[model samples]
Target: MAVTSEPVLAIDVGGTRMKGSVVDAAGRELHGCTRPTPRADGPDAVVEAVVAFAADLTARAGGVAAAGIVVPGIVDEDSGTAVLSANLGWRDLPMRSVLEARLGVPLAFGQDVRAGGLAEVRLGAARGARDALFVPIGTGIGAAVVLDGRPVSGSGFAGEIGHLVVDAGGAACGCGLRGCLETVASAPAVARRYAARTGRATPVPEIAAAAGRGDDPAAVAVWAEAVDALAGVFATCATLLGPEIVVVGGGLAESGALLLDPLRAALDGRLSFQRRPRVVRAALGDRAGALGAGLMARERLQAGVGSAR
Candidate 1:
């Protein structure tokens, strides 16, 4: 059946919150809602919450034809299983099957960062680029690599760029590594490091402003360290993958050039015989995940791949 005219449900399941939206085939949202993720209550509780939230949205949308969901961690989209989400505390959960049974519809599932990358490529900053890197820096950092205009999953474990070690002897990471990029480069890490040095808790934006203005030595040092760490990663990426553009998103990317300009400069300072990628801020912002989910659902419908009944 050609159900392209019907609306579809899209959900982006984050560690701390779940965002849902219903969109028509043209990708314009018809309805949307956000709910707190009860992660502290356990993984099963989080799954149940997703089901309930999705159900409510479906009903509110007057019954969507299908649902598209994206989440963090290791996700095997081929099998529709959430391989592992340390934040959500799940391993090998058959999420798509469960959701199909509960929601009574076929759906599409994907990793959140990859989904965000897709949205940016199709509709946002990375549009018209054949190869790009999409990295969203928030509570943690993750990358989505687009090669030949398609996001590569590497069998569900590809884009763990946050775990890449930058300071091998520095802070311990939750993933049992020392001095991973996320520990020093993420938004929270920047603020935490600033507080530890200055005895004052300051956000990334303020720290960035202070660094740019050269007013605070602590802020300058902390921000410079983060930008340097990220530059090293991007330099390595430029050498290995040679992406034409790198789209930086999430809360930290909101700093705009305060982040990208320094990052581009630091990356250039490191690269001598490598392809330099243009570092740009993501155009979709936080809604990229949900919009990507909607795109996935519409693609599923267009391809005649119905969700498991």
Candidate 2:
């Protein structure tokens, strides 16, 4: 059921870059473009970059049918508004109309993580999966829950697993909460917290290396806490959604066996009384968000065509 009409312009707005792609119905990018996020310059500049990026791709692609934009924030998908992005510094942005006007194409707006989950379910790791979870462990620990082939964006705000309060009295989160999973288990937390305790400023990969050696007390303590917190969240998500698989992604998942081995063990122990979903790494890696947005755009166009017919 691949709709071979005009391609779509896919945009994924991240803290670091605004990635753009002109993609076909089958989730293949025809032309790729990216720009650095103007964090100091603010939201308007970012929007401008997205528009320029889309225009470049559309020109290269000859034309585009629609645009799909995935943003990092509490997105009000119903209204196509970015509710707030702490990292991107946007609030209640009317993103859909802005892009539609700029790019001159129908726009489908979505949360970045949710869109990634959509990509996974449709064409990536979770294809044919009735239930699955996509968790990206990077600067933060965010998740997207997919149930029965559709992501459960509960009241437009589902799968915010990072803010899940794992420790009531732990470190304060950016959302102003204390002892959040993000505060404990995110990649930055893994590095910075380990450094704070040991007074050694090593990155997460180095910390994992030390942990693998099994002698660094700082590595043991921080990695143990991170793994425990992450496992706790996974167990809770599994207990709730009972997914067939939980696909893990983001910068931290690159740790490979260092992450998977202890994570599996901890998750298995935590889910002793519950159904344990197989926790695996995401297949698409860094491109999941962009690819996911492209998939959603194709679906939206298909649905529109179906309804019209």
Candidate 3:
């Protein structure tokens, strides 16, 4: 009798959507689905959606051995608590316990971007690098730090690099701070700044394209400000952590050389004693979070590490 292995359930919950998957041991996704996160309906609604989504994936997998879930915001992985999610409007929620109780299985829980960093190191762009940064810049900005081959959680407060102040007395941030890196460099910030400057609405890609051709002075200026802000942040990271590489993902990274080229140059110009990191694009795209969740579940299952009720 050939004993087949049971798959594991993986869910990556974001402010806007939840990605769920049934994954086999080899990191292959056997099945997958996405659902709106329903955060606007309130946090509890999002929780219910996740529970239902996980149950559906488990059922489709014919019973999963375990599950892993990752979410945005401040996640205390050791304590299995979601400390805070500004976007999701929740704080100090016992996420792992809640899910484990409903799912009736051992579960692994973590921060979404940290999970993405792990997936990158294990299976994506940052492979073979002991120290790296996986930064996903989209609706918001966040960083995942890998040090000595391990992702740093910092008791759920470690990776808020977006809140790092780059421009003193500059634009306000949703985090209630002024001059945050996110204020100047996030995807929306780029578009918003351009729109404010020109009174014309444009997407980031179009802006980057215009900037690339040097045709639109506004695009060039906006793109330069974003790039400069990012360089400032990355320069700080270089001096503080000296990561060997940086994997840039999310919406802004789609700009490719228009972003990375100037970023590398700016970062290099700032470095004298610090080892400059090789900045590159993330390989996994939007699926990185889900794949990371799967990797976490599979690794936990293999190591017999889980949150059991």
Compared with the true structure, all predictions reach lDDT values of 0.90, 0.83, 0.88
Q: Each model's TM-score, in the order given?
A: 0.95, 0.94, 0.95
Supply candidate 1's per-residue lDDT for 276.
87
> Model 1: how far is 230 from its true place, Å?
0.6
Output the worst ten-in-a-row residue range by lDDT, candidate 1. Answer: 300-309
Q: Candidate 2 clash total?
A: 0
Ranking by TM-score: 3, 1, 2
Predicted candidate 2 versus true structure: per-residue lDDT over 241-293, tens digit per residue: 78889888898898888888899999999876677888888888878888888
Which candidate should be chosen as best, given lDDT against the real structure?
1
Q: Clash number for model 3?
A: 0
TM value for model 3: 0.95
Which tens-of-lDDT digit does each residue in 1-309 have in candidate 3?
112256889999988888888888777889988988898889888888889999888888889988999999999988889899877877999888889899987788899999999889889999999999999999888899999887899889998989999999999888898999998999999999999999999989999999999999999999999999999899899999999999999999988999999999989998899988999999999888888888777766666654321
Q: Per-candidate RMSD vs. true structure?
A: 1.9, 2.2, 2.1
Give me the runs in candidate 2 sitting further than 4 Å from their true place: 1-3, 305-309
